[model samples]
Target: RDRGGRGDRGDRGGHRGGGHAALLPPGRTPGGTQHAAKEGRASLRVSGVHGPEAGLNGIYLPTDVESHDFSCWHQNDSFYKVWLCRGPRAFWIFQPASQRGTAQGFMISKERHLERPQDATTWRLWRDGGWKVFSTIHVREASPKDVDSDAARGRAPPKKPP
Candidate 1:
């Protein structure tokens, strides 16, 4: 069953939201705790201890920043549960759960979700062609050096980095 309180139908129903409720718990992350809004669009701030797989984790934002899809967004302008599967190399398995009937085969599936990237820094999020990367930024207090550098370059410092 999905977080929506229904059995998985495999793509024969309407688009659903709140898919990440099962994967992510409220106010929990690797470095600290932060809460995602329950009813509005928000960013999923991913953080983890930098290790041999340092590049494996980072911030994942929806293709539409304003999109209510707080989970993974598909190129077709829908949200999906992007499963990162381990193989010789890591890959994605996104079989969107339907709400009405069984339709599990990928051939009949309409949504083309995020495909694997050549490297950890990018992902193919669009069909026509556009690759996006997980944000390497973690929210923290900026030092005076950062402000000075921005001013020297004639660029205004961001009120907040997203």
Candidate 2:
């Protein structure tokens, strides 16, 4: 399931970019243009179940987009779902424990923003089992009118139950 995430990243073959692009080392992600990856991160999802034993795991996008790194999705809430994209960039997904090194301890059900700067965070340490995670959001692209229209037609994004 580990496919095309920006972090804990490994090379894959599918899409092919032009030869010798500067964004990555030679022969990394092929056909993935600088424009695609530069535009933003690709959409991806987590692999396997969540647990302390789980450590960090796979992060990959759909096969259709394995070679690209740009996405457009709608989001209006204070928080939205996201995933780490595939190489030099990633969000660093982890077990979400209360204490950084204690993935074996309590784990948060879901993610909030990173509370500390990248330097201060222990969850990023591979030994702690942290892997990069990311997503490119376009909340700005979803207008209030579009939102109203979707909500009126019942095509809106899902709302959390109050």
Candidate 3:
């Protein structure tokens, strides 16, 4: 289970407040959320259990395993913040602990105002006795003018032009 900030009160576009408080890096908060006064300080606790169907412990559908609560904080320095839970466990499908590796049933913060394309990030859960980061895909925002130009051009630009 998980608990953190509340969802945005208005139609301000997917912004939330008073929920899972992740640690901030130095002078930055992720997605403009309030940062903690100290570094590496988690404003909220994240914990959950993974079932056998999660493919953990070599079991196709093992019983639910309880997970320890992890301290999270907000950091604006990076486009996103990541937290990994060591050991074979499952996190809450909703709220703060949004799965992002190879597992199913994960949720992202409503306050995360960035618009992401499909497959931009893949959530995975491994059972090698600890939480491991399988992969991460970062999506950068395109400027309004760039988007307009791309639309006019009728095609996306190459990853890296020669």
Candidate 4:
């Protein structure tokens, strides 16, 4: 630690905000975590220690409870569970249980739902296309305790907004 008290490494490239420090890619951060780059739109990034071989382990899908369909949003509230599988060539698996159905419970089918970014807080699906911004994901994540309760632990979770 230097008498100056930043870091012995000496602020290789960090930014201080609200008394908290965060290191940016190249250098320091300024005024907290600002937009890395002001571009048309950014990639949907769901990051955090998912193993190189790990797919469909950290996050869930926005489609129906199945993954076969290559879609983010469905018409009406129709939703499916899709898993992005990475083997020879990455593909979205509709639902492994689609055939046998969930061994534990019933299937989760939603409708009138359009494809939206799974997490809008971090990214916006941006390309040359135009899309509106809306927090369409009305179904919030249930707490662990709530999920563990027998009501939903073994049975299929109740459809939200019902």
lDDT tens readout by residue for model 4, 89-121: 111111222211111111111221223333223
Cα lDDT of model 1 by residue, 30-98, tens digit: 222333423542223323324332332323323321111223222211222221211111222222322
Weakest lDDT window of 10 consecutive positions for candidate 1: 99-108
Q: Root-mean-square deviation of each candidate, in angstroms? A: 15.3, 16.5, 17.9, 20.6
Top-scoring candidate (TM-score): 2
lDDT of each: 0.25, 0.25, 0.25, 0.22
Model 3: weakest 10-residue lDDT segment is: 55-64
lDDT of 2 by residue, 1-162 (tens): 322221223422111112222344422333333222224333222223334323223222212222224221212222222222222222223212111111111112122233211211233222233332222111112234545654565433423211
Clash numbers, per candidate: 2, 16, 32, 33
Cα error of candidate 1 at position 20, Å: 25
- CA displacement after TM-score superposition, residue 78 of candidate 2 (Å): 18
User: Which ranges of candidate 1 are over 4 A from the true structure?
Assistant: 1-39, 64-162
Q: Identify the runs in model 3 with alpha carbons over 4 angstroms from their true place.
A: 1-26, 33-43, 51-106, 109-162
Model 1 TM-score (2 dp): 0.20
* lDDT of candidate 3 over 1-162, digit per residue (tens): 222222233211111222234444432222222222334222222222244322111101101112232222221111122322211122222222232121222233222222222212433332342223333322223345544553464433222100
